[model samples]
Target: MNRQTKGVLLAAGGASLWGGSGAAAQYLFSTTDISTTWLVAVRLITAGILLTAISLAHAPQQVRALTHQRRNVGYLLAFAVLGMMNSQLSYFLAVKYSNAPTATVIQYLQPVIIIVWLAFAQRQWPRRIDCISIVIALIGTFYLVTGGRLNTLTLTPVALFWGLWCAVAAALYTLLPQSLLKRYDALAVCGLAMLVSGILLIPSLFTIPWPHLSSGDWWLVIYIIVGGTMLSYTMFLQSIRYISPSVTGILSAFEPLVATLLAVTLLGTRMTVAGVVGSLMILLTTFLQAIPMQKILNLLGLKHHY
Candidate 1:
């Protein structure tokens, strides 16, 4: 595959896994006594250990080098605490307060947040297509969340608060790992971040009551650690290597669509027609924003500018 194709695929794959994982987590929450705190802590720690081990076998020298450098270590620590930890913890907290739909839709605001930050930081406006995509995303998110009945959803203040926080955390999660990815294996970076994040969450885990689980629940927990946290994070960090964080954020919008589908299939939730259409728009906007202009033009038999 071409570079752009690979990048988009990686992002989409990662986002899909994340969406499925969220659905799985929602299942656990409804059926078990697992606190979000324990879930987050264990996921980070376990994912961290496994990912780091794999990377160590694949690129031991680089992993060792990263540890030896104080500056790099500092960066990793910050990425872990501020980026990975904040994003994962805040997201689960949001879900704990509200349902998956509320949390996911609100956190989907990350793309807009990234876009605005980029615009301000670069002191320039986005292209017309970018603006159009953003507007579409906004409309789609609104429809998906509210289902055309603006007053149908009722959210507590805590839910609203954590939902917004997840937005900020999502933005950070996409943006913070770029430098690390440039200098180290993406797997190693994510693994270490997850490990550190787990350590940081250790105290919080103790405070929360641990949930009793059946054998099936343990299997589900394994899926969250391996498929959700490990695979999703590694692929996510990998995407930034070939695409901008803004585009990655947009592409990650696939999460909500997947989440909604899984919800309908497994949780017996109903999806309104407008909600489905809105989900499509959100996904379409992501690809519309992600596809390179040259690729689209070539497909249409147009001349290239350079």
Candidate 2:
């Protein structure tokens, strides 16, 4: 296979593994009394340790140099607390309250949220495609949540709330680490963020009861920590070497699709016709947003991308 094809496959595989992990997590939640707090804490800490060790071994000076800058330290802390911990913790809670597919699809709202934020924060009106994307997202979200009904929801209220919060956290994760990522190795930044997030959540662990895991449960959790968080991330990052990031973003939509299929097959989760249509719409928005509008516009002999 060509290099680009290989990268696309790798990226798709990584996203599929991540989606599978969510289904596995849901299975564990159904079978075990695993607490969200406990799971998030352990996943971050264990993955953080292993990743940090690997990154440190690979680039000792670079990793250590990041710690010396006070501004970098501040960024790391913010990334840990808001991006790493917040997203993962909220996502787990969302999964606990709803199915894996529901949580995964809801978090797809992050892209739309980012667009809206950029519009307000940058003090600019959204362009034509942006406005269309927003409307498409809302229509999809409406169907996903209400199942084409008014004044009621298919998902529980608490699930909806946490899922939206999960989207916000996901957006923060996407945006907040750009500067750090530009300067530091990806592994260095991510490992430290996870490490610090896990450490900061330590005190809260005292308030929550410890969880007991069976052999099977431990296996599932390991899939989440290693396969989902670490290896998947590694593969996805590597994919960017061969393909444009916009392409990678488009391929990563496979995540929710995989999650939904796994939910239906393993977990016996059902979706209404409206739900399926809504998901397609949201998936379309992912494709729309992933388009390099300027490049496309140039190809079309148009000066304006909007």
Best by TM-score: 2
| Model 1 Cα lDDT, one tens digit per residue, 1-306 | 787777888888898888888888888888999988899999999898898899899999878877889988988988898889999988988877766655776776676678878888999897666677789878876676567677864456687688879989988987987887888877888888888899888897778888999999999898888888788877887888887766786778778878877887878766678767666776666566566776678889987531
Candidate 1 to truth, TM: 0.82
- Residue pairs with colliding backbones in model 1 are none
TM per prediction: 0.82, 0.96
Query: On residues 59-114, what C-alpha lDDT tens digit does candidate 2 reach at each position?
Result: 98777877888999998988999999999999989988998888988888888999
Model 2 ranges off by over 4 Å = 204-207
lDDT of predicted model 2: 0.89
lDDT of 1: 0.80
